[model samples]
Target: MIPETLLIEYNATLKTFDKDEIIFSEGEFARNYYQVKHGIIKMNNFNDDAKEFIQGIFYKRQSFGEPPLFIDVKYPANATAIEKSTIYILPKEKFYKLLQNNKEVHFKITESLAKRLYYKAIIASEISSQEPSHRILRFFDYLKNDVFKQEGKFTLKINYTRQQISDILGLRVETVIRTIKQLEKQGEVKIENRKVYR
Candidate 1:
């Protein structure tokens, strides 16, 4: 993550967006570097059947859609605010200059992307042939242990809803609900007040 001091150095502007607002649509020219200050942002695309598939979910202090600024291409997916959110936006050129001038920040960004890539790789492998339960647990574990960097016995409080989970895993919502219930029965998860914990 770029520190607040560093964002100021790059003249990044903090912008607020309403829930369900489109940050940018797929195929649009990428022009800014966005970092979430609060709330959830998701990059997604709809398939031929009109089903929505999530590319990635970005949370507070996280950044998204950086590849286009680096490679000079149109966005490959749409980004939207899942809730009323605050985001810091830096002009693409300024962001490039900022990265060029700040080796540490650049390294951090690279490291962050690398971790996300690793998670994607794991998910890709799981989705290829694994059962629903295996896929779900593997995905949940990665998000909890690697992406979130949580430690100890069990401390992950599932944030996304069951439908969201199903979309991410390429499964039906009914399947996700059933699988989660089975997981809870098997002591693989804990559901309290409709929130999942592990």
Candidate 2:
């Protein structure tokens, strides 16, 4: 958490976005980091083939944009609000100052980065050798372990459509649908009007 004084000082400068609105674009200046106060945002990249790959779908109370901004590089992914959202934006210099003044925040950010890297490593590992079905299963298992809110039932802010999900996991939409149906048949999930309940 940012210090109370700092939050107050910075609170008035934040911005809000509606569903599907772009928060930032790839190759944009990395001058600010955003703290999500409400709703969800999806971060993704487009390959040379012009296909979008889902990198992450972050929910409320999460923060992103540090890695690129810290290195003073352009944003590597595009961030879009998946739902109506409010986010606080702190300029790079002020953010660094906040980190310096709050040791806990510094520790927390480092820990977050390490965890993200671990997940990225897992995705990379699977992409190298795993079949599409296995990859999707592993991805879902990861959600169950890390992001799911309950046992036996998972509710996620799935910002991507089936096509986007298919692209992310390198599976065809038909394959993704078939795999999802398999899961549904096994009572692992209930697919009803895009609300995946498990």
TM-score of every model versus the real structure: 0.97, 0.85
State how far residue 42 of model 2 sits from its true place (Å): 1.5
lDDT of each: 0.90, 0.77
In model 1, where is the ten-residue run with the lowest total lDDT? 145-154
State the lDDT of candidate 2 residue by residue for 123-143, as single tens digits.
Answer: 888888997767776777776
Runs in model 1 deviating more than 4 A are none
For model 1, residues 165-196, the per-residue Cα lDDT tens digits are 88888899999999999999999988989998
lDDT for model 1, on a 0 to 1 scale?
0.90
